[model samples]
Target: MSQFKPRRPATGAAIAVLAIALTACGGPGGSQDEGAATLTFGVQAPPNSLDPAQLHDGTQRYVWGSLYDTLIYSDNEGELQPAAAESWEYSEDARTLTLRLRDDMTFSDGDPVTSEAVRVTLERTRDTAGPQQNNLGAIESVDTPDEHTVVLNLSEPDPNLLVALAFGSGVIGDPDTIDDESTALNPVGSGPYVLNREETVDGSTYVLERRDDHWNADAYPFETVTVRAIQDRTALFNALLTGELDAGTVDETQAGQVERAGFTLQRVDGISVGQIVIADRAGEVVPALADVRVRQAINLAFDRQGIIDAIFLGLGQPTTQIFNTLSPAFVEELNGEYEYAPDRARELLAEAGYPDGFTLTMPANLFVQQVQPTITQALADIGITVEWEPVPAQQSGQTTNWGMYFNLGAVAPPSRTVALYFEESGSQNPFGTTDPELDGLLEDLAAETDPEAANGIYREINAFAVENAWSAPIFLQSTNWATRDGVEYVGTANALFDIRVFALSR
Candidate 1:
């Protein structure tokens, strides 16, 4: 998952609430599981391919944990806790870090998690030249001094490294586990859960059983887990209602219905926003969406509240900025005042010379379809008629052409979230235009060791995004689903799709 921005006053509070909520879930002394438990996991959409190193997704992140453990972890409370390494010390200069390893841990194949293995795994991640690479950007070098120890030499300090490790790409695996085929296709991991079996027929699905000798047996919550690729929400809801699915992905509109049907709605929290990005493709002057008035007009025209009521089913709240509703960064003061403004929208439209109206094309994949109708109505109100079509997902690991395209992205991290989606070459910045100042902001924040300093930059860029109207926000959606009654599951912040925390009570 990517990060979010802190533009609105309410963002600070949301991040605080999320941080507090995170603490109640996991920690050094974990809560005791009542007893033996088995869980069934459900995935809305099956992975295009199960390669963890490819593109990190929520489902993929959870699945990676099922098979592997990371050297470090960003626990539910957003703190770096030990996974492979028990404790670590950073140099006073903040350039180097030394880690103490766990001696008892072993791979499923009975191989010990040797210090050499830790060094090698990290080496692979840093090998930009390697097939499975990424997430080790901070560290300039890695080495192992002793059997129970590893050292990382960083070019700069990175407090977010632990959180970064929490990503699917950061999970540590046995060096020998890498098969000639895709590591994600079927990779061996050192996690508390192990793959029990794979019954591939229609679409691929895998079953995971808890390891009896799990390294963190004291913290292991569930005995078994399963993931289902159910993309259709209505079908998923029906399955939940009929006891077929443990739970399913839900729109905010359906939240009340689920509660009424005797189900608990575990708030699906993520930094994703339903922003309609007006990309400024680098070539043309008005490139993709260079007209600031045009961007503002689109924002003004979209009846965000209407979408909340119609598509999200009244449970969704309208947001003016791109920060997640759950972040402490989104405090009360920053909560935006830019409610839906129609006349202003029309005026902005005229300013952009699309006075009468403009035809806008909206993309709809299974995910986008959830809000399609509401978006259509919102655009119509501002003289912008929308043409809805399901844009086929890109075949390569690439995004669709940057333009006035309809799409949804999860800006998961609030601190420097947009940078990954904007600045870097060949990164997710779909608009294609590059700004040196914006890239500089990203660089400062990425390398800033101090949270307060990094936050200042975050505020700066978020304000810039809003003022420049670089992006138009729709709704901040969650990336989770649920089972029917009788399933004991916690909607984990750290692990989005972790069925490992689920257990059937009845």
Candidate 2:
């Protein structure tokens, strides 16, 4: 999901903590009977559609995660775990993956969760032109030899394939109604919870009733799960303070106040990397950006630490590399390669035959307004003039005249991150800048089967990208979650917010 700025309170002191009775047995509706348990979660937005194939990462996972069971599960630390499929083995060439499913599992509609269901779900997801379609592009076909055995035949070796399955690509839907238009609003899956249609209000509140027949029901602690969409951050914070929400995401600026109000704060660091993407590295738009020294000068122009302190409230780590800290490709030395040196930056600009610097055009949107002034001033100091073009958030991607723009890239495994941002076909590589050395390294990484060998190639790619100044990386973004008393949540390193990580403190 693209990063967007959330609305914050006008002033920190403007919010008042209201004393509302916190119930021990129920949700936002106050107290309930002895055996009833509920979890009311506040999300920034509601799911655009309930179809698993159409779902994207981030907030959408708050609902789809509980409603469907993925073939594999990713833990808090990003380790692969078994979910719908009890066991899986990769072929010697790493081109085929065999899965063994639990025969006892059944969907909410009482249909058996067989190998055919997995085949149909994967095929449907691959066929649909959705955000997750790219995740399954390597699959040549799916084979189901029996009711419980499913095998995936790949066209080539995919190092990130397993990790992809642990996310949206892995979500299994009911084959019977997955294609029906009604299934977009009403979903059917073999999951821990069943959507309560009577209590659900589309686009506002969704109530998911626990399914007793689900084999993995014990993993989810709440009997009833209510996901509410509160777009305004201030209102969501108020809901947490007033005991209307058991858990919700809060900005770093509100972390102190949230803790003082008796809510437990959980943070996952390095979920994303905020950077200035120099899209026209080939200098197709701006001639100066084509110079290696010019690109390096741009990297050294900004004071990343200062921006992190002022804009992020000191909740991030300054870095010059795009790879997340947890990734195997991350190199500690590269973080300090491009120190804040305005004099050196100016020297580099002069050496590149642009002593007066050049004018750069970039798209401006509400999502990037918070850091626009700082970026403009930083480039101005190094002799570059920035011309801002007011563009709607929806139209930001369509406008391609920009030489550079602020972006928050999702952190994932090295291979997946490379595929999504660095490769020619990458979503983030809008300009399609290609280097022969980088291309060869990426091809080697893709074909390598051994974990150690693949990671070594990733490190080489990381270093090469940094040396070339692929982007002026600022810092790693942190995602925070706040929970009321009696509730506990463990955040994941990824950008997704999975409800399964939540549980009762007791």
- Give the candidate number with the greatest lDDT: 2
Tens-place lDDT per residue, model 1, 1-506, is 12222223336677566434433343211322434444444555565544444535455455656677776665454445567777777677667878778888888778888888777667666664322343466678878888888888988665445555555545566777653364656566678877665543223456667787867654554565556666666777776666555556666656677777776667755436677666653424233256777777777766677776766565555665676655534533433545678899888878777788766455566656666676677778888777765554422112444355554554445532453445443234544566777777777865676677776777776766676676677676654455555564554443334444553433
Each model's number of backbone clashes? 48, 0
TM accuracy, model 2: 0.84
> Residue-wise lDDT of candidate 2 within 198-265, one digit each (tens)?
99998889999988788766566578989998867789989988888989878887888989988889
Please, what is the TM-score per model?
0.79, 0.84
Q: Highest TM-score among the candidates is held by which one?
A: 2
Give residue 356's lDDT in candidate 2 (0 to 100): 91
Candidate 2 Cα deviation (angstroms), residue 396: 7.9
* Worst ten in a row by lDDT for model 2: 14-23
